[model samples]
Target: MASTTEYSDRESLGVGSIVGESFSILFKNFIAVILLALAPMLLSSIIAGAMVGADVALGVADPDFSTSTSVTTWVLTIVLQIVFYALTTALLVQLAYDSKLGRPLQLGRYFSPALRAALPIAILTTISSILAGFASLALIIPGIWVYAVFSVVAPAVVIEGAGFGGLGRSAALTKGYRWPIFGALLLVGICAGIVNFLAGVFAGVLADVGSWAMIVGFSIIAALSAGLTGISIALIYARLREIKEGVTVDQIASVFD
Candidate 1:
């Protein structure tokens, strides 16, 4: 019934409320958030580092990136990274809902659904990111707009079990609120970006040729950033459903049970 309602009949997206709730959720579950995201991120880095080798990632030596072999390796690394990113995002989406609902954080229960959704999420999200990347190459604003359009793919896929249709679902939900959504994401992203930058600088501590400190430190920062970003997206998705379809968070979280 609510889904049949027009956009004009719906409420505002409430960027501020979503942003506040995202920060609250992330702050309250800070350690758990980081840990939930750490494994996939750390593995991604290791896999990418192994594929590209120290010469490329650390610049310890000059390797011809123009070579076909090197190009294939880089592409493979990107694909793997996207898969891990999707997996991490999927995990965090479940955590966000459970945490928001004040439910016990059963991290294990989350994995079953997350793993089931990860492949489709990875595929659709790769398409979204590639589109965003191309738009970014043309201009920055278009890239942000494109990203905002599909910002909730992970949550939609995992929660609604929408699979490949997640992209369309996100696009539809975000249609009228892309700018506000982008604003909310950018505000939170700036905060996370600042921390990530500091961590990057701190990672330089006694580090050269991609030392363990650099690897582990950046991975930790990335894990934290991923956690915050994923939580924001989850909250945004829930808010969008509430605004446009009169759906409650409880209704959305019910799928996990």
Candidate 2:
């Protein structure tokens, strides 16, 4: 099941190549990818919207902003997001692996590996998020830097079962290739942002007519954006392994068995 497609060698990929390859994979497996990613993405969006609604409610109902409800909502949203992102990342990585190896793209078939590795993934994702947050708080550049280095962490968790050690694995994979990774991520982000912006614009136009329609519009956009991000990262993870470990797509995917 070795792929005929040649991924870029370690440290050899440019931003354009990464972006192109990601979109290619995404388009090729559009339905499977979207379906696999939909649940987690939509749940996360609902949780996010709840968090916002909670804050708004607190502001309106309790002007002092001294409510336990706000605190609880914040905590719940953060925890749920950590789980959602981790599971979705793991699922998407497996999907990308199967896609690369020309295996069946059954959305249901990918869930077992994701759930099997759920705890470790959640832990690693939470840590990565915290570290990135701190980096951003210290300085924006460092935060972005940390994010790029840890971009492969989900793949590491899925393929190597590196758990929390996936952080180190990701950093090693990206060692001298940080710039390309960052560039690739930035381009993807810009594209996702553009789609999101367009969606928001459409939502706003609907908002003047009905709030529920706007909510539905934004929810669809959020889910689509999340799915796109997951697929792109999965592709990146596969490419990183090919380049850094000199592994074929099938060899890396064998970890699932």
The residue ranges of model 2 lying beyond 4 angstroms of the native Cα positions read: 1-11, 50-69, 202-216
Q: Could you give candidate 2's per-residue lDDT for residues 112-193 as a string of tens digits?
A: 8788778877887778888888889988767777788788787787778787788898888877767767778778878888
Clashing pairs in 1: none
What is every candidate's alpha-carbon RMSD to the true fold?
4.0, 6.1
lDDT of 1 by residue, 138-181 (tens): 88878987899999999999999899999999999898778778
Model 1 global lDDT (CA atoms, 0 to 1) = 0.82
TM-score of predicted structure 2: 0.80
Poorest 10 consecutive residues of model 1 by lDDT?
A: 1-10
Which candidate achieves the best TM-score against the true structure?
Answer: 1
